[model samples]
Target: MSTPDAVPVSLAEIARIAGVGRAAVSNWRRRHDSFPIRIGGTDVSPQFSLAEVEQWLRDNGKLTDVGGREFLWPRFEALGSRDESGLAVAEAARRMRSPRTRSSHPGLSDRARDLAIEAAQLGRREGPRETFEFLLQRWLETHVRQLSTTPAQLASLMTRIALAVRLGASEGGLTVLDPACGTGHLPAAAAQEYDGEDLAVLACERDPALAALASARLGFVAEDRELRTEVATADALRADPFAGVRADIALCNPPFNERDWGYEELATDQRWAHGLPPRTEPELAWVQHLVSRLRPGGAAVVVLPPAVASRKAGRRIRGSLLRTGTLRAVVALPPGSAQPHSVSLQLWVLRAAPDNPAAASPGQDALFVDATRFARPGVREPGPDWDALGSFVLSAVETLDRPDSDPPEGTVRVPLLDLLDDEVDVTPGRYTAASAEPSGVELAASWGDLGTLLADLAGHAQHLSKLGFDAGTLQTTATVGDLVKAGALTLRAGQQPAESATPPREGAVPLLTVPDLLMDGKPSGLLCADSAHAVAQEGDVVVAGVVRAYKAWVHEGPPMALGPQLYALRVDPEKLDAHFLAGCLRAPANGRQAGTHASSSSRVDIRRLQVLRLPLDKQAAYAETFRRLRDFETLLTRTDSLGKRLVSDVSDRLAAGGLTV
Candidate 1:
């Protein structure tokens, strides 16, 4: 068995542990003679003893409290498969439950006991809630192939709809149910809706380990509220734990298209009040189960695959649900809503139906909202616009309750009788028109802006074509380190800002980050008034300290605070020009020399960067040329953005009959 100190760490791991860039780590190795010697790997990427690096950090006041779970996670993952890690997390939660208890859980193997002890120590340092959440989140990430979690956006939206219709019940305020609560995100969302009210959560999960985690998650998130949690480990369909307890509000995101959902043995299950769900329609079974658990006047939200709305095997059940007004709205969510991101999923919001058949509303209409239209265009990452999509679906549901209100675009309310045909298809996209034609005024304005952008781009291209470069004018160069020693320039490294500081209100200073520097340093972040970090001046040159991603430019925007992986070079006006120095650093030869290793993505050493030695009058000529190049680059980006938008706009207008040819 290898001890925790015997573990090896790479240079990249050391930087992550210290919460700084690799350049800072390299600087430490050069300055401190007591640094750990390389014990493994090649010269380009060396490995060192974990224990030695940790001691050096403590002696130099760089490390505090084992770096909070970073040290333990590697050892924990080394335990074995994901199930082993999950058991360790469960045992850690048990240890948290009893502060004085240190005994190993009978479920964990002898190999995992050491990891559980390390996790307990972490729990003591950081609060148990935070440490436990971090461990559980990592565990889920590692096991994404076997499990899936509902997005917080979907959870909150479903919870809010339940809250709107939930009536006062059972002196205990409201009872919320999650029939398939994976990690308790849905139930937690419901718990957060009402803090002062007496609450009770009834959750069920097939996996015992996950059931324990869901219970602990709720315990942490519930805080000081009067909350009672009844989480059962058995499958909800096989054995109903809270069958007699009808809930006032409920939300669930169930596993879709499962074949072995007890269709044969439980052929006459009483929960299937609508009809017996077919072998291939497990999502429909979950829907009926959740709906059955609701009180006479209660409501529940369930997420299902799009096929359930129109599957040939489930058409009878779909029609029965529509005829009784049990399924009120079918909302088509955009891709990336759940595991199978290639296909769009549907959210079925179910309301309690009457017991007698005659009491069902005969003339009621069902709302079909096409939220697939809310997917934003030109986004590289796959995910719906949660804020806009959620608002659209929730508002469409709100419109259903008020018959006088007009339905919004991408939404339609059809008569339930029209949907009671032989097919009984309730797909939202089939009934609702997703895209609407744009007005003539909007189309005209877009065309005019596109023409202006194209003209400006052409002008910039012509200006850049006339400038000629002479390679014979090269001069002797001095390293940035040598220039600093001679009092010609000053170099300052940026610090990592707290992530809690997001974009602030008006009057706050913008923070110049590495990404911002790459895109001309236009301040993509913010630093509040109380912050005391150093700010870059107008004439200072900022450079990104990363190889293969080199970017350098003179600061021309408002005075801004510096972010990590960035360096500011403040030059002496008598000796150097900011634009000239930036252009020198931007050269490919200088970038190759500044990089510390052979790898293309190595961190840069600013001291190794070189600048040309020229007279003040001679430098002014080069500075003017560099300034023009910067303008051409900025104009090129603007032109590319406008060109893409015009292409999309023109195609859309042509399809909608707003444009001819």
Candidate 2:
């Protein structure tokens, strides 16, 4: 046992190091008798000795030197047990980050020193702060199953909302605090997004390792931007680390459903200025703690489970929070927006009641935004539409700042008196009213529009059905590859652009994403201009490469950027009709053929897509029929959309007392 200097690595990391697919790594582990033995981890995902794995790769000519981070990752993992790896990495970061104080800090193992030196060198090469951030992110990703790190997008959204609330105050500079800071994501996001140069961040975590990592990360960000940050390791609820330290803004994604959050121990703690939180409702305790830590007129945004809004156990505290005008806004987020991906969470923005002559009112209304439908579509992992979601939040906050301004749709200003009655249910949906129903005249107009759409759909269907096709006369078929080889068409796959690349700020173009194709051949992704992106020109046939349901579309509008997991087929007008090719690619038989290589997601080889090798004139005839069918589909879809809108409008009007039926 050569001291196990190499860190244990997951199969995914091994695949990356060997430049192979995860399937290839599984095959090697199963088939090769001489493969590295599993040293740790569960049987399902065993971790192997990094040194042995590297040696085996080298012996088999599969190894290539990528960088120090790859080599150093395992060593950091080997420093201690899995629980201690975070602290070890944090120690190494602290040492590498400050060269002058490196010798002063004692007790670092010889192995830790060596790893620190390597990290320092890598940092120097790739901008020390950035390198360390990347390493920290990778480490967090490796332990994501065990860690409760906030998702980057959610962190950004929370920080933005907190910033917006803070801007309403008279504070010139901000001191942002996250008492339950898991990995310092909120603090770092705050430092990055806050426009002020005079800023300070304070974060506390119960886990020592996590606290150390957060401290190191925030310290680095602060140093880079000449800001101030402090991180402490302690249970925020039990121990008041930052006692008497009132921050201008506090942002936290507190741990939810924490049963033993020092309830009995901190019963008399002064932080519970509101009614003491019931033990069953620890999120409420966190809310009160955050409010206690805020200066008068300061704001705090905390992520809590949806239960807190209406849970009977915390009704007293909820009412108190509302009556005091401390609870400012509640915004509901869609599922999979953050950790514990199964549940939909809510962002509760709290502000300390201002101590002013005009602020003596006991029951102030709070802004409630129901943004549950703002999630971007995906196969299983739906992401947030960051721009739209953030904009909605900011707009809601702006509406709150103005006393008489009406909140936007999916949002409302619920009176505290109404909220405190009976259920005291502060759920945004409970307060948000649907759009007012249309008038009788408007309903008649909608009906007329629906009838017109139906007529158009019927006409298009009739035209499509009238086209004659002889199925008995078969034509020779060829793969898309064959057609490309003969220069009949060109096939190109879109490459995902760099994450840091900025999109065009103006005249943003729609991005045709795979999810958009799977939904209904619509462009649902953010509209942005990226010069480096691949564009699908008009008349080109676009097809989804990775999918559960096959989708293909013929480009009919101005050129738009093609997203990843999609292929664009440019047809030669003299050789093939674009619509005909699109229809052929979208056929059920072609879908089955493309699904051959697909498992969970389709990995269709676009070149292998088979199409009929008909003559140009015949292809044109088929394309004309396909075009009419496409029009019929368009009309039917539009009609369905209009019908839904009409029904919703009618229902809303009826509910709002604007309509009779």
Candidate 3:
């Protein structure tokens, strides 16, 4: 095999990297003075050395041809197990990428083009392993989304796992193992966690190709210890690579909806101490395999389909485990935790033996953690928090597993009798209490005080309509300027006042500059520049507004200095509802139309806004709707927040391992 790092790139490489014709580089050098030149010259093509060219591209803020295509490099020989740079392979890849040359290879299909691109990327080394990991991660993200999960769900899962490691009951040289290791992710995570320690991980993959790839990647982390490094190509259920071995912890996310999992052969297995798992239900089989492998008093966490928690066939096995007092905790994650499919996952935490052998206080109780409530909106992952749930579960395990300790209060303890009564209903929500009321009771209590406020607003609208103003009802239509008598809406057009126009004055009121108005009619975080020309009288609609697709915020302040793009509308006494008009103009539909008409550039022009047929009444009607919508949104936000907090608090208590489920 060719030395992986000793590979060289040539003129064809330059064409591929730049995504331009070889002649384009020649034309640029011959015609432009900006091009670089090699020290030894004319005979060799004018392509700059790769490193120098890369640096120049970076300096100019230009993308190299291989910029987004970095995924093609590092895996060349390793993936294909080739020693030398296959000239035929390189030539084939080059021809496939070039449309002009592609016609000559009519035999190649669209699939062939994809393979060729992969080949090209596999042969280069633009950065370190971390960069390659990023590329690999993105690829895997796309694959998972295509298969069943979204990039967001994967990210959420990873975040939860990291959080668990950081706060959970894991201790004394942490270790991790994945029985059904796909690409050895669990082991790789373990490798990362135990970077400097002698950590052991055994991964079993049935697919030879995948096993080879995973073994190659993890060998560096595993070092030379066989126990620390095992990537055997065998079925995990039928063949336990580390047969009698155990670890500090085990983490697994097995394939779901599996049926006919070799139940006939493993019926009398020692792992099935709880009860024999039915052949029709493979989920329980995997669960049994994972639980039995745990060391005495060791903890095991596994992701399972929600059905397994209540399935009748698996009920006997699940009930046996619960009755034996080995079942520790169960947490139900929110739906959409695993993207695309939106299936909620339940995490089952089981211990091999009780922590305190002599004194068992409610050891027969299993903690039910309903963490479905604590999910934050932005976490686009498999579900709520696996890591958080794991941490809470481990914490419970620590306290409950101890030789002598009181079962902590607050954690709900469901006795085996209760579980039996419910017919082995292991769902967390089935045992935990419903969420408490929100804390903002005062805000809710004063809602009956809104009638007067509504009357006042209505009276103001009716008074405006009587003054020959069409502001109350959505009937009369008029342009903004038509209704705004020149004196009424004193249009204060913005100006770019000089920096030296005015110095900061002591106790000076802040200005309402263009930057102060956000697309959402909110003020920006920026402080406005001082200007004597800028001023805002009370009741004047300060529109530091812009007409654009992209959103921006204006600065906070009353008499703010406005940028050239700003337009301050000082409302004439009965002509328009200045607040209502500002909101209508800043509406998303209006901004989108304005953006459509603006000149094309790096940024949209926020000044070309035009309201051809809009009237004051329509603006008022819409404004009222917006106000009510905002109130509803606020209520929903509060409700969601309260629900999540309760779930988090409850999950924390249950994870201490003291409560029974």
Candidate 4:
């Protein structure tokens, strides 16, 4: 609800933003009287003014790339209240709007003039549109914690779906609406997706600052791009802006679970045609309001919490929407699609006009696609594979009543009569193949895999017994750095690979990210084969060079582009065994020795890791032992996965009823 820069920043945060160390900031504070004064907090942990520090950094040339994230946008945010900041951005846009268009300019504040100057300089460097984006991107990153923003991925998904439906029925250009267009991500998505089309974007936001940002960003970015953008500074639901105009495609990712979304006052608002939403059911209200703005045959894609699908309070509204066939597909998105990353969000794809539901939708059965399984597992905040997830969802939509007749996986359709039960639970997980029992053949194969895993696991246990031997004389250990210098190994720190497209490009190479290295799965990301980065080859030692947990692997898979937060060690086979080095690196002692941070999230300095000195034959002996242990862990993981699947399949079958022996 508040801006990220609202609170004075600590020295640590200053250093972080400046991409420097705390020591550097401390030195600056001690040496330079020009350094920003401590605005708040104690001497040991003093906080400085964001605006002053940024200005000091620039004046002293401590900062470069003014448009970069190192310095955030519209310094006026740090000068006064959020509204004041909004006014400054608006004033700057107003001044700039004239010069480019030959329109008259207005008198601006000193701060607004500064902002206008910064934007103009950047605009001269990288065009006007790019300057707007650069400014916005930095602002977004700076306020990531403060804003419950509609993520680019979610915005893209919503616009793509809504626009797809609208395109089928509309001609020429289409009008897009985002009633709660926070930071204009939805409108941005629409503009970017259909840049050549004669697009009209209508946006409204509660916060004047956000509204100004939306207007300025749209104006500059959409310049010369045939975009007609209108951003209003008012609560669209409360003010009902553009209520008379029906949008062909409406996309909204409204504020969720708000107790005071005008519930007490807007009780009689005409948008509630389906039914009056309960006080606790604001998502339903958002859906109905967004739906009300849609023209005949128009489509709306709304992002909502999972509870909206089955909440008892909204049952009446849900039932009405279903009955009228206004509600179409209720897609269950993977977690991390939006702000509350932990909650698997839902997308309510709706048709505007209830009078004209798609007639060909057999039995008028509502389609449900459970795409939650596409979330990248083992990630701290797992995001779905958008390309695969979106494509699967879209494909499933195309196959309305034909349940599970194809491959991208989760899909099921339930007759409206079946769905209109006592509970009226329209959760995709409840009806899709995700919750369905696996067939007899699938179960048989699972059982077979589990059996094989167990057999291999049991057979490997004996090798561990022979690993124990009499204690030998104390031997010296060499650091990984020493080994690298001795020509026995080649250690290359990983770099961030380019973001892989969904399904990837034809020639994009497999990129092993830290997540991929930890999960021991095929690389989920991609990199250009021509990119400048080390390719992890088979038999190389791959270490997840991350904070906290210790994880290392022998790269047994095909060559892959090594991504950031990973260390790839290519050892001379005759000098050092790959498996042995990986196993030794996995040791807690090595991780502790290499760790820089004392906190739970500790960094691993691979150069400081120590490995034992041994002959080639002796190294082979240890390598074999380590290899066996790695195999055991792999088998354990696969077996556990199979065991869980078997249990889930069996339970699902029983829960569905009529379980046979």
Ten residues in sequence with the least summed lDDT for candidate 3: 78-87
- Residues 1-661 of candidate 4: C-alpha lDDT, one tens digit per residue: 2235444777876775665557668999999887877877898998877778778888888764434433435354454544454555454455455455432224345655666666555455555555455555645665677677887777887887776555244556788899998878889888887755678899999876688778887877576588888998788777877889888889988898888888878999889999888989988889999889988878899988898899898888888888877787889999878878889999988876633455334356787888888887654345777888878777876564354455246777777998898878888888876545678898889888888888888899776766666688788899999999999999987775422113458777787666664564557666667767788889999887666546787888777887666788999987888888998888877787788887746668888888999888888888778888878888888888889989988887788687667
In terms of TM-score, how similar is model 3 to the real structure? 0.55
lDDT for model 4: 0.75
**What do the candidate models score in CA lDDT, each in turn?**
0.78, 0.77, 0.52, 0.75
* Predicted candidate 2 versus true structure: per-residue lDDT over 203-225, tens digit per residue: 89987768878988887776668
TM-score per prediction, in order, is 0.72, 0.81, 0.55, 0.80
Query: Candidate 4 clash total?
Result: 0
Please provide, for model 1 over 1-661, each residue's C-alpha lDDT reduced to its tens digit, 9 standing for 90 to 100. Answer: 2245466677777876775557778889989999998877777898777778888988898865444666665556556677677778867766776667757656678778667766877787777877787788767866888897887777888888766544334454788999899888899888887655778898999876688778878877666677888788888888888889888877998887789989998799898888999998998899899888988757888888888898889999988888777888888988877667767888888878644445433548888988887654333335678888878877888775666687789888898778888899999887775334445687688777778877876787787788787899867988999989988899887776643312567777878766554444356567775665567778898887887567788887778778776788899999898899999888877888889987866878888898888887899988887877777777778778877876776676677563444
Encode model 3's per-residue lDDT on 422-466: one tens digit a residue.
Answer: 458788766665323223363344333344444554555564445
lDDT of 1: 0.78
RMSD of each: 6.1, 5.2, 13.8, 5.7
